[model samples]
Target chain A: MRSVVSILDLSTSEINELMNVADDIERNPEFYRSKCKHKILATIFYEPSTRTRLSFESAMLSLGGSVISTPDSKISSAAKGESISDTVRVISNYADIIVMRHPKEGAPVVAAMKATVPLINAGDGGHFHPTQTLADILTIRRTKKTLSGLTIGLCGDLMFGRTVHSLIEAMLRYPDNKYIMISPNELKLPEYMREALDKAGVSWRETESLETAMPELDVLYMTRVQKERFFNEEDYVRLKDVYILDRDKLKTAKSDLAILHPLPRVNEISVAVDDDPRAQYFYQTLCGKQMRMALIMLLLGII
Target chain B: MNIDGVNNGIVLDHIKAGESMLVYDYLKLGRLKCCVAIIQNCQSKKMGLKDIVKIDELIDIDLDVLGYIDPHITVNYVKDGKLLKKRHLALPETLTNVIKCKNPRCITSTEQELPHVFKLIDREKQIYRCAYCDVVGDNK
Candidate 1:
């Protein structure tokens, strides 16, 4: 009866269980290959997201599940003026589960209200991407081997990065995990998140200078400074390359430190860092698939 | 022109004239067993145009829901042709429990069993944000 809507929805115990399931899937691929056989996953993407949508589809297909999807909303009945609730209600009758991505902030919530099956929010506006948080958590745990007692640096696009917001919420649940937020004043984390962190008693600091905080961080999580997110071209031009992870920055960071980025990079990370032993972005991408597979199996009660 | 007041009931006054139906739908008052009256498009000196609703019994009205739907509603409790309590419902500083946020990508929106909670972050702005997603949307 549970649904994976937000990273916050899963308690510490449930998250550990999900990570354990993901770990098991990573260790034994053959055992879960046919876990979702004959089941259908309906991906109703109202917005454009190639990687997230493809990963979900690949994860389901890898588990022997079929995908019924509209990769683009322009091609779907949504272009004909159908409400998300109406579309999901009809889709729920045909599919066992629904994964939705919408431009509007609460489109997934509206769909879940009308859906009879489990609803997964792929992305909703600038609000939340819980599955991405799962991938991030899994990657963090795999890289660090522990979720607690680490000084994590979240740099760039803090305001609009849904992944960063969700990840911060997830990490705040762990004890002794400090945060070093590196972003310009305009792109600082929202007041609500800062308040939540304060309430949770998590130690955190904000700095526009990433170099000052780099050497102390156990994990440096970088996010793209999206041009579309900026209100104007001038702000985008001024701050877009403020925190690029080049060799100079990497020299300041600890050799044991891991660098993570939610992919589809736009020059925030240098291509040269691909060979660094600490660069785990490629591994993070693979973890996304396995984590999604685990999520699919768990949701379908096959695991 | 004077509309006949209900014999003994709760009266919701000062609602935006055309928004009475929205308030009704928001409260799901149509499903209630109590007798109800929706007076719309009435002339008002203060608000230009106003609406009123009268219910036959005392029900626990969710003030947060009222705040979200129409913060202007003034609730009046009438007993034996006398106003017992006449008060303007103030929006909560934080809406912990009342009114589900309409955002699906929000955690509270997707989880079937979780309470649909929102907090009133700014009263003057008529803004309510999802406690889970931090998605802010206007109520008015």
Candidate 2:
């Protein structure tokens, strides 16, 4: 009866349980191969997304569940003016669970309200994306072997990076975790998130210099500096290359430092750094699948 | 000044004149199958002009709808030709199951079966936020 609407909805114990499940899935893949057996996962994506959609599909398929999907709503019944509720109602009858991604905020919440099956919000406009937060947590846990006592440096696009907000919210739950937010002044984190962090007693500092925070970071999470988010071309041009992680930038960073990026990178991360032992973005992608599998199993009541 | 009394009925006063039908439609008073009276463009000392809706049955008024349409309306409950209770309806704290958000990209706006839920996050500011998308809309 529970729905994955926001990261805040999951208690610390529930998140730990999900992480444990993800760890087990990573260690013993064969044991969970048929766990989902005859279950069906319905994916209703209202916006275009390649990685998120594919990850959900791959996760379900690997867990022995089939997928019923509308990859493009524009060409489907939605184009003819069918409501999201009607779509969810029809799909709910066919699928055992639903994963929804929409351009509008709260679209998945609406779907969850109408759907008889458990609903998972894949991504909703600039709002929450709980699954991505799960993936990031899994990656951080696997890399650091512990969530506490680490300085996590979040670099680039703080304002528009929905992942940054969710990650910040999740990380604040752990002890002795400090955040070093690196972004251009124009792309600073929203005041509300900063206030929330302040209220939670998490120590954080905002800075434009990535190199100054690089050496102290246990994890450096980089987000793409989206040009579209900028108000003008001049602003985009001036700040686009400000935070790119090159070999020169890595010289000051710790040897044990792990660099992570939610991918589809547009030159923010130099290709040369991909071979470094510290590069964990690709591994994070694999972790995304495992975490997603854990989520699907838990939501479907198969685990 | 001549106004007749009604037995076991509710009287709504202080509504902006000519807006009784909007309040009636917003409340869907006709669907209740109750005897209803809508008085429009009535002169008032405080409001200068006002409207009123009198219903024979005691029913819970939708305060969010009333708050959304016109916040100034006051509901007066009558019992046996005497004023039983008088209330000025206030906006709900958390609006669930009513009032669709106008944002096209809002999840509630697209979802057909889900009840449109909005929360009155900022009452003084007259701000209602969609429970899903967190988009803020002004009641005014």
Leading candidate by DockQ: 2
lDDT of 1 by residue, B34-64 (tens): 7898889888999999998888877878777
Interface RMSD of 2: 2.1
Task: In angstroms, give how far residue A109 of model 2 lies from its true place.
Answer: 0.8
lDDT of 2 at A127: 72
Q: What is candidate 1's TM-score against the reference?
A: 0.77
Tens digit of per-residue lDDT, candidate 2, span A1-303: 677988887888878998999899888999999989899998888878899989999999999889989858889888898877888899989999999987777877767878899999988876788888888988999988999999999999997777888888888899999899999998899765786788888889999999899989999999988775555899888888888999999999999888888786899999999999999999988888888998888887776
| Candidate 2 clashing pairs, residues 3+ apart or interchain | A85-B111, A85-B112, A105-B133, A106-B132, A107-B107
**Residue range A1-303, candidate 1, lDDT tens digits:** 456667766688877888998898888888888889899999998777889999999999989999998747897888887777689889999998888987666567667778888888887767678888888989999999999999999999998887898899899888899999999999999877887788788889999998899999999999998876766899999988888988888888998898999887999999999899999988987788888887777777776
Displacement of residue A228 (Cα, Å) in model 1 is: 2.6
Q: For each candidate, what is the lDDT?
A: 0.83, 0.84
If you score just chain A, what TM-score does every candidate get? 0.97, 0.95
* DockQ, all models: 0.17, 0.47
